[model samples]
Target: MKLPGIKGFDEEALKKYFKNTGMLLIGKVGSLAIKMLSSIAVANYLLSYGNGILTTSVSYVFLFAALAGLGLDQFIVKELHQYPEKREQILGTAFSLKSFAGLICIPLIYVAWLIYPLEGIKYSHIFLLSFMGIFQSFTIIDSYFQSEVKSKYIMQVQIIGNLVSAAIKVGLILMHSSITFFFIAYLFDTILLSAGYIITYNRKGRSIFNWKYDFSLAKKLLTLSWPLIISGIMVSIYMRVDQIMLKQILGDKGIKEAGAYNTVVMFSEALNFVPIAIVSSLFPAILNARRDDKVRYQKRLQNLYDLMVWLSLSFAIFITIASPIIYKLYKPEYISAAPVLSVHVWGSTFVFLGVASGQYLIAENFGHLSFIRTGLGAIINIVLNILLIPTMGMMGTAIATVSAYFASAFFILFIPKLRQQGIMMLKSLFLVTAFQKIFKR
Candidate 1:
């Protein structure tokens, strides 16, 4: 049952690992491919700055959506893993909480709309896109499936939605559709994901109609998840607030700067799936290890740590080298994005470690520590952005992002409670132990 390359994994576990990661990898690659093509199309059509309008619109929604989710995606998974018999109540409460959060955040989203440089697009376009999160609230279903390692179903849903969205973008290109429509396509994709998740859930012989809300369950979920919500908000800010700051700092020319950085950031983030897909499949296994076998849990976690570091380090080097070529593939005006890409892409290293560590924190009930680490990153990012943007522009924002990610992922590892995870990350970052293991083997 043992695997050849990946150590410490049995046959069935290894099979499920491949099955889950394979589906997720396929979905992520497909989604990223389509999105890049779409971005290229937008760049050609709208130019970099006008494209900024589109990027900024979606960024707003992302920030708001993070707030709207209440950080229960992982909570639902943890709950389901611990209590499968309570699936109906757990999911029902999750969905209602998400819906309520979404509705409550909409008004705040609207009040802040006019602040964005919408180019020629209407505020209403951004407004409509914001509501996509409410529908997305139903994606609690994905968490349920993820806990069960049935991501193939989720993959099917995502792949279908992405294909349809890509087709719409192609049609938009054929018709020389307004840039506004491209942004609309983005919203449509969100809708499709929700629809697909719901359909897949029904086909699996479940109904939301049977999903009954338990107030007590909801309260527990909320209490357990509040730190995650805060952490999510901080992480969201550290990630997206830069784009907004770019607009504010640059004056009339700001949107273009923001847009250019957006593309580079997107390119950098595309490969993030390497870690995410792997972690998603491995998380349930790690959590179960905590219950059944502590030694196996720590060993497996270490192996994962090594793997994440190696993958992220390799990708960071590759992107730094290819930044110019990657940017030139877009448009001439986008060349400035090359430096941004080089600097920004390095964030992926810490991001990978951070993501992997997040699963462990949840499994070990250190969500509050996770939140504190995230808050430190957010504070650092905001302060750095403010100080650097006026002088360094987009590249400044890139620097801030990288530094923030490092603080969150690596810097706080100096703390005692988190020292073990920090050590694992450092090993992955430096490859000290990973190399030793390889040579010894």
Candidate 2:
């Protein structure tokens, strides 16, 4: 008789699973290493003020970039999996729509640049960051490789692009390049990544040019993804809006204050790849299981939650304890940020669980609920930042972030639709249930 709840995977399927995940994990490490080194170079060369400018500019661009994406990247990934035979049409249409969205975002960037109150940021920074969003629009190409379970090609191209970008960054620091040069390096990296995608696509005997846009296709994808667009903005708000809030509230020392928070966030941000890479590699399998076996699907998701939570807690604890040493890896001037990093890294626990639960939202087609949860979190973060930043400064900012993350990830238990997922997240958080389930198998 067949056992219930636990679906056994054949050896071949298991091998393929690890192969896809292993390649991406390795690439993430290489990419993370290069970026950390680059961050060190920039932190020292630009100092606090410059680093703040970099962080804020990217954050500003990212929000609008999400709007420009029209949520098509994710829509494409989902559609591709369900209808692999329509790959050409889906990819072609997504590229066309995404490119148009990228173009539209250009003028929007100018509007933001003109209306933005801060005179502290340079125009070149605005211009470079605006275009960075446009280049990022091309990343729908990466989504195509993902649908085919061919992450190895994407990994190779990403590493090559990162290596080139790292070399450029190193040279800029050695030559004492202006901030514009650094911006150029940033833009160039995106260009190379897009080019790399195209190169790999062609090498595999496919042509991006063959892809065409279908209005009906666009409408269908958008129908499913518009919530994501709004949710994306809300997510962006809570994630990056703290820097803006701190910049404004901190008065004359605004830029430096933002830099201080960002310095601490950088280390935490580097490790975010752990959850993203894991989810990306396994999500297709999860999708398949959702159709074939609900019990097994739930079990796999629980396993993911368990891994995400334990790993996040482990990282948070280690980073909190070693914050002083981590700070020393940056310039001595940034040593004050050690406590900030210590306080801030704890947010990673909730962030990881949030990410894991978010997969359930997508797989189960609870996109509206996803938005509600994240939107609520964003509002909470903003209010907390406004109330707390003046008195507590960066410490208050850290607390606000952690609070918002907890609210988003765990507060969903009260919602009727998301109640089960929330309980699963809680199980992952405590580990007792999750561990029992694991060893019982």
Candidate 3:
């Protein structure tokens, strides 16, 4: 049967799309489950202070790793789709660029560490995780698989990696291992995933050795991707800077505060994979609609926004109600995170809308706009953290996160060309779209 509003997609194609998305969703959900259970164990084992140290170190490394990626994955997939024969050049140049950036990042990270140091976090943790960027260069191959619509392979690699990583963490807990061992296990997670990607690619009868880099192609890719690189950095800031700021701003209580905040964040952001899986599976179809039919294109985009709003809103509501009980699973000290989770979970609604609309931005080549919005968000988050943390504590950080995400996602409205989309998203958020459907039916 033809689904209402999705006019252009036939039944068979829809099946294929959902099947692919379902496979990825299952992998992500399964991995999330493993990580959640193991993370809870680790959190309880380490308690607030130890968890705070770990969260701070990971967030710190993550900010620089964003730079090392060069923001080439989306463009690589786009290039591969448009010119399949240039696969080698696209992948090769992307890998080469990322690898160089990865190498440069280590020294740059060292310099950064020297400039702004976090209390309770060791430079050794930063040094070890910096190498994750190098191993992550293999993730360019992940884009290749995505372009080929072979996310199952990527899913396999992720599940295997998470499983192994979780097992290692669990083993360490059993062994009564030191915190340093957990950091090493974290690095091993990236190394193992990169290895899986290489093995999967090779098993498919492709040789990484055949990939060759072109200087001109490098220039072209960089020119096209520079905006994304900056925007990605901005995104990293808003997403991660909270914990860093919490750790730094509070001084004596920083680590424990960060720990509570990080615990709630893991819970709130866990379901983020839902939107990503749906969007990635349906992205090609949306692009095809944009090419073939404008009306259908708008309909599909509206439908996607509507789905995101409902899914995320429901999640937020559920978490809001259940957060207190959820905290019971943790130690008593983490009970403070319960209220924060209730507040932070609402941010996912905007996050879901943002992820869906972000695809539209990429498809329309409004890369700079992404940078502007995300940059705005980073500024907002930083300012709020500085202002609120001293007075309101972790709850202040939660409020700031939600507000920044809302501003970033809806910033499109100020641009006349994209105002229609912003309005469409509003309709979904307000249930105007659902009411319209009900009335029509």
Worst 10-residue stretch by lDDT in candidate 3? 1-10
Q: Model 1, which residues run further than 4 Å from truth?
A: 1-5, 113-122
Inter-residue clash pairs, candidate 3: none
Clashing pairs in 1: none
Give all TM-scores, in the order shown: 0.94, 0.94, 0.97
Predictions in order: lDDT: 0.82, 0.80, 0.89
TM-score quality measure for candidate 2: 0.94
Q: lDDT tens digits, residues 57-108, model 2?
A: 7777777866777767767877887898888889887777767777888788
Best-performing candidate as measured by lDDT? 3
Report, for all candidates in order, the number of backbone clashes: 0, 0, 0
lDDT of model 1, residue 69: 93
Ranking by lDDT: 3, 1, 2
How well is each residue in 290-377 modelled by candidate 3, as lDDT tens digits? Answer: 9999988888899889888888988999999999999998999999889999999999999999999989999898977888999999
**Model 1 Cα lDDT, one tens digit per residue, 287-316:** 778789999888778878777777777788
Query: Model 3 segments beyond 4 Å from truth?
Result: 1-9
